[model samples]
Target: MVKGKLHSIETFGSVDGPGIRTVFFMQGCPARCLYCHNPDSWKMSDGRETDIDELLHRAKRGMPYYGNNGGVTFSGGEPMLQGEFLIEAMKRFKEVGINTAIDTSGTYYDKNTRGVIEQADLLLLDIKHTDSEKFTELTACKQDPLFKVIEDIKEFNKPIWIRQVIVPGINDSKEYIESLNEFIKDFKTVENIELLGYHKMAIDKYKKLGMEYKLDGVPEMGKEVMEELRALVRFPGKEMKKAC
Candidate 1:
């Protein structure tokens, strides 16, 4: 049985994908976003080992709540780290008639990983920063891999929900948002863009783990600023939900 290091599982996760769903927060991530809430998921060797059958069994229990829109979503610490493992699990989920989705940074795409990603029913792609230097600054990671994934997935015409963390001062400028909007035009499969406001909800989690919260003094992005950022994402007739 193929196993993956898992951080935790949310039996009834509503935010990861459409409808009510089972969300798996698998272990490991390549990026270190300044505002990451689940820093605990960064370490691959620390999480519990989970098997595909076990995850599917748990998913089965949530089938009733899944309704028509609900199903299974694989999130992380970057699920792409364990792409092949998830491919087998996702294939099983599909065999069982469950809708499959992946919440990924889209940076780990390759032949094997892309093959699995191609099989997902939906993709919740985290669009960190568009500017390569700024992207590296924000996530402490490169952007080329993610761009490649985006390019590769476009050929399949699969729906993708672009998720971006709107950090105040760092990426809230109108110019920056305009640039992002321009860049987003390249994606034909994007269903919508969800701009998440920055918050300090993870300070306590960082403190508990004996890690210094880098953005400790940073105030949460206020409603007014969020609204301003929200206004810039509108693309004529394109479907979108702003300032989430």
Candidate 2:
């Protein structure tokens, strides 16, 4: 049986994907983003181990809510870290006519990862920072893998929602948004760009976990600023909708 280390599962999460959905918070992540809310999930062995069958059973309980617009979303700790488990779970969901989505950092792309992602109906690809040097400094991870994943997504012809967390001084720059707009212009599969407002909601989580909260002093991004950043993306006016 294929199993994965899991941090936890949210039965009725509205933010991770379309409509109402069940979000599987899989364990382990390669990126060390300074503002990561779920620092507990970064450790590969920190969570419980579970198999696909059990997860599917839990998913079925929410079938009534899933209906046509909602389904399952595999979030992280980077779901791609457990590619084998994710692939099996995704296949099972599809067999049952579930709409599947993945919220990933795209920090661990490879042949195996690509294969699993190709099966997803939608992808919430997180772009940490557009500037490679700043991104490396912030997350201590390479952007190459993320770019590669985007390239593969283009080839696979899958719908993708590009998500970016707007850290005040880290990634919320006009230049970075302009660069991203140019970088993604050739990829016709991009359906939306979500500008996530930065918040310190995870500071308490970091404190409880005994990890230093680096952005403790940083205030959450205001609505006006978020709107400004959204304009920079230049996504069609009709597609610019706030995600809560």
Candidate 3:
């Protein structure tokens, strides 16, 4: 029986992937990201054990809502942390004529993780920071693995949607966007770039979980600034669409 540590499920998610989809928040993560909202999902033991068959049934039930562009997305604490289960589950979902996607931190890689990424139809990659020093400071993990994953994604020619959380004082500059533009210039598979406005909504979650909220004093990024940042991401010749 192929089983996965399941944190939670969103039956109709619009943001994670194309159209409306079933989003699975799988358990466990290697990176201790400072801005992580789901502190509770860090432990693999805390998640419920879910059988692949059962998950397939649940996805099938939502087929009506998931039109052509929509299907299933395996999101996480880091979906690749449970690589074996993800590979199998993705396979099962695809067998049933469902398109599959993965929302990953791109921080873990192995044979299983490679297989998982290769199997996915679409990928939502979270870029914590473009600068190596800042990336390590923010996630408390080396950035090499993420680059390695991106290399593999390039090798496999996988379509990717890049997402980044824009912190007010930290990376809210045209310089940062320019660097990001350079960083993604080589990625022919990039579909769009989504700049998420940093918010303090997770402070309550951290408090309830008895964890320190690192960005407690940082004010949320407003719509005006977000729009400004979005505008800057549209470089002269690049066709990438700016998303919030």
Give per-model TM-scores. Answer: 0.94, 0.93, 0.95
Steric clashes per prediction = 0, 0, 0
Residue pairs in clash, model 1: none
Candidate with top TM-score is 3
**Which stretch of 10 consecutive residues in model 1 shows the poorest summed lDDT?**
234-243
Tens digits of per-residue lDDT for model 3, 103-141: 988777777878988999998999989999999888888
Candidate 1 lDDT? 0.85
Write candidate 2's Cα lDDT for 1-244 as tens digits: 8878999999988998888899999999999999898999999989899998899998988889987779999998999888888888999999998889999897887657888878899999898877788789888898898888887788899888888888887767778777777666776777778889998899888878888988878888889988987876865333434657
Candidate number that wins on TM-score, 2 or 3: 3
Model 2, residue 43: what's the lDDT?
Answer: 90
lDDT of 1 by residue, 104-149 (tens): 8865665667776688988898988889898888889888888877
lDDT for 194 in candidate 2 is 86
Q: TM-score ranking from best to worst?
A: 3, 1, 2
Model 2 whole-model lDDT (C-alpha atoms): 0.85
